[model samples]
Target: MNRIGAHLLAGVFRGFGTNAKVIETYEGLDLGKEFTSGKECFPCIVTLGDILLFMKKERERLGNRFNPENYIYFMPESDGPCRFGMYNKYHRIVLDSLPGLDKVKIATLSSEDAYSLSGLIEKEKIQDFRKAAWLSIVTGDILDRLLWRIRPYEREEGMTDRFIDEAMERMTESFSKHSSGKDLSCILNDLVEIVCEAKKIIDPHIPKKPLIGVVGEIYVRTHLKSNQDTIRTLENYGAEAINASIAEWINYTTYDQVR
Candidate 1:
């Protein structure tokens, strides 16, 4: 969401200078509930709502320093029959009428659009983007799983959360250092050590908690904002909430492509 993370993510731009930002906030759902039609899909409503809230917050922060020209919406679309394919057009249509938003640029990577429309982002950059993106997702998914796995069982209520935050920041620092260009083997060793240390602090003989499986839409299930921290809430209520694994989506995507 901030500089180092964005640099690691967008570094795939091959100096094309793009940044990755994620809208993961509970405030977005509040905005979505107000602005979006009730008929819309929950994920769509949250996505649109997050952008709107982000814009408002940024405007407040920037005040006189704000410039619409500096911001660009990175809304990628998939080659699918789902309504998600229209989000880019929907965003454009909606933003066009909003004051001070018409001038803002949108970088859409849809199957039907000019994929290489941005002169700075080209074929080789696309390959870099793909590799960086996969690493990002895999790293993030493991971190999420680790947090979820240990949070419920921690000796102290906030220990797991605090440790995960520190670990993530450390990971960001590693990413910002561009460790991928060098011997990447030692890059995440500290994070692995942190997780191991965390396991040592947890009570080994704590009574087993009841397990609950989470099943639903991919975004809602895995995303904290969309799901309203349901898994954490369940954990607080004395249960182990097992979220769908990242592998599920990967396999599903592969299956979709093949069949």
Candidate 2:
């Protein structure tokens, strides 16, 4: 599990800056399934599936960095009715079912667990959480924007994915040095600048199209399978798709509840 844990740390750190790569595996199937079985659909599950798939790839690439025979993984766990609480167990089941992966270990980091790996990292460098959160938000926003804009002219089946991987790597390197609050602000500004430049480059190629906003349950909106592949489907039909931020869902469910 040590190797897995190390990979997780590296992944998180990389994810914060831009070196991280997120590959979508189950999106196609998930989208198709959700379109038919409207009920019993969970977008969060789809997102978890993507995360797990990426983790598996990362584990393979960084083999034996910490330990060759055993590997460990971590997933964030939450409480309440968000359905996130069950993800840890579900991920374990899924991973175990994969061939040659029965020995893989999955750990959940709870909000209250100060001794968790992420917690340890945050405690050791208090600025990491803020920096990572900011980077995650900006990167997600950029990818979401690109997916909506380029879905129509995407010559290759998974061109959006390759572009996202490249963008993540670029953005990660851009901010890797600056983890302070001021640096985070600079990163945000730079992200905005990059996005603006990208928009100028893409606007000429993207045709004017109707835009559809997808909103509802948290998992459904973020997970491609849960929402019936709404984004891609919309794009295929000449519609631009905008997915509401997951942070909005968090605020609606938790922050609003607390208030």
Candidate 3:
């Protein structure tokens, strides 16, 4: 997942009383590459390495206190020809083959049911959790849009990124605090104010650049490292870039399931 999206999702989980965090990614690509055939999708390999690296570091830190059974890895999947649908199963194989990680649980939210939480979470809390998750994802998408929209026309270099960082932090805190109530009005209002502030960062004197629409495999397009900072590159070349949103896939899967 992209950074903002990942963090906001974690906040959503925390709001529902689940402790979740996005692990450092890309740094463990070598470990992920080593475990799988080179044929796997790049994002799959990257995520595989990320979990492996996190687990290894945690085990080293906790030593005897490390309990793989106490952890549940959340890896969502879709139903389709995309290899993404099989990531959890493949990760399961890798985790099982590893000595200490075999006991760690892998929890999946499937698109087959529009990512229903029927078995993974308490029955009574399912509706609220799903609603919060949806809103959090939408917020994450908006944050990304805010960055791309303003950064290219910023009043000063690096100001857009710094402001976005602050916005993401504030939004994450809001999500964590307000999601439990199952009423996202407060979160939405905060987002509106953030957007208004972001608009102020844009310079009115700078003419708009050629607009570029980026579309591709969700990971490659959104993951800065995977795409080698494609969006920034476009902005540097005097173009504004907009990538597809993460929420689009979530919506598509639901529509597909219904069809």
Candidate 4:
């Protein structure tokens, strides 16, 4: 999953008092593989592992107080040809098999209705939530592009990553504070400032490298471990790379519905 997008989306949920958090990825991969017959796509396995691992840790943290009803496992679905539609059901079966995990609810948004939030949240706040989510996702896409553009030519090694980390924090905070409001101007202003500051990390003296465009399955393309840090690896070999943005997929689903 796109780290920026996931974090910002979680922040948007928090703005509405949902207390959402992004799960740690790739760490629970073995658990995912353990549960599967290796017949599913890599993304499904990895994500399942992430949730399983998170729930395991949460159970340990809470000792006996862990209430499955208190948490919701959010996994969006697609009505498209891909097997993505079956993932939620498959994961439900897996979760139900695990002792005490059966009570943990799974939440989903489908592409069939352009990911309508009708049942997920209160009717009065659905539009506001959707608008905030869109703005957060767009911000994530912009931040990711900024990272790829400057990281390759950063004046100091690790400086770009460090700056981006700080920038993500600031943006997350901004989202939580302004996302509930009708006007998105405050969030846009903050994003602009972060992008402007990101530009300072680039060293103009470095010669440009060959451009490479990465296109593939969304999970493999965005998840670093799944793709083995393909973009960063390309940069290491004297090329700059830009992967497709998550926003593009969201837009496509919307367009598909209209057509």
Candidate 5:
């Protein structure tokens, strides 16, 4: 859920009978270690560990109800000279070793396949999906902004967090109800008010602590396991730590198109 858009995207996919999820794995470094040879790239290592964790947890909780068909991994691919092209293959090799999970589908939506695979979805659903995807991306950005604006200056711990959860729940509900082309501004306005009311900010009269900016590799920056929980540790020490949101990457890519 690093992009945050994926959380909402999962709902869109769910409407099509595909149960998709975006895993923002925690405490997975050790799990990654246990599952991999330590020679894999950090992203691959972390992803493998998280997938393993999901499979294990599902198997435990669902018992016989968990079906591999219901748990597909959506790994989008590109025509690459880059090693990213190999991720799904490596994932398959590792996953085949685990019983019951060997049948879990690793579905790749490659850049090359859009034309050839367009028929996999109905035309009507594709239009609806486009609309849902747009809203998801925008909503994620709003929620992320709300967190940074409120959390650091929150008058009470957890109150801002509570509003965030409620806002997201309502936002998700709104998205689920509308398939396409409904004006989201009405719901969005309500959400903004909810966030503005997260809590009172710290008194501006008092001296403020130093601010820290986290800057580095995108994967390391997004994954707490990869960064050794740097942001949370900073927040715990009474300073505000700001990291660029994943929306920054989306905007950067979009900028590249125009330039």
Candidate 6:
């Protein structure tokens, strides 16, 4: 019976429906229009555009092997500081507008409560905690570094996006097979070492530059258009600007709550 179950499981995994294409939708929205006029608004349309682009790329990559009906796009939501709590609704609305995407699941992870779609998934597969933690850390780091580096170089026509996409693909492939507790620690250490090396590689220039600190709603700070090219404008004026990452913010918030 065990052998039969193993064979069946193998068959299922080999099929397209067995593997889910998880879409990270937290940073998908680009809410630049609302922030331009100093408006405290949530940019649902921008977020929708980001998700659509991701879905299109996924479909192209997987072709017939992509099981759109079985895939899930995870969107994290919170109920504080702004109207961001409605991000899931906005995401669904936007997703519905796109053709052939009616069946895609747009699930939510709420920061306000302990119970969330992600939490439930994690709880149901309790033994997969190690895998989940490793994924959350590694992907969060990679996205953070990529966003920080690419945002500054994005122009009307540039190759930063292509570079980022390729890097993300590589990272994702590497992450899939590495989730054991020992492996997770080793990966985290390796990531820190790499970042340190990266800083060294780019440390030769101490140009007299202005330093600007960007702070605001998560969407505004990360979205290029929302801050009205604030970072670019700062760089144009010979300033080195920094945008704190949402991942770091979340990590700190979680840590503080535990304390």
Query: Residue by residue across 54-88, what tens digits does model 5's lDDT show?
Result: 87888899998988767777765444354555667
- The 10-residue segment of model 4 with minimum total lDDT is 114-123
Writing each residue's lDDT as its tens digit, candidate 3 over 94-164 gives 99999978999999988888899667677898898889888988899999999999999999999999999
Model 2 TM-score?
A: 0.61
Poorly placed runs, candidate 4 (over 4 Å): none
Off by over 4 Å in 5: 3-6, 15-17, 21-24, 27-31, 77-84, 110-121, 179-182, 199-209, 252-259
Which residue pairs show backbone clashes in model 1?
none
lDDT of 5 at 205: 45
Candidate achieving higher TM-score, 2 or 3: 3
TM-score of each candidate structure, all chains considered together: 0.80, 0.61, 0.98, 0.98, 0.76, 0.59
Local distance difference test values of all predictions, in order: 0.64, 0.53, 0.90, 0.91, 0.65, 0.51
Error of 2 at 185 (Å): 4.0
* TM-score, structure 4 vs. true: 0.98
What is the clash count for each candidate, in the order shown? 0, 9, 0, 0, 0, 2
Task: Give the winner by TM-score: 3 or 6.
Answer: 3
Q: Candidate 1 vs candidate 4: which has greater lDDT?
A: 4
lDDT by residue for model 6 (1-259), tens: 0111122222222221235344343344443232223342545555565567687777899998876676666566776665777767766765676677878887676666522334434454434543444245435546555444544544432444454454444444434444423345544554455444334223233444555677777666665555675766776666667766555656655664566
RMSD of each: 4.0, 7.2, 0.9, 0.9, 3.7, 9.7
The local distance difference test score of model 4 is 0.91
**Total backbone clashes of model 5?**
0
- The residue ranges of model 6 lying beyond 4 angstroms of the native Cα positions read 1-42, 52-68, 93-102, 114-174, 180-183, 203-205, 225-229, 251-259
Clashing pairs in 6: 29-47, 32-226
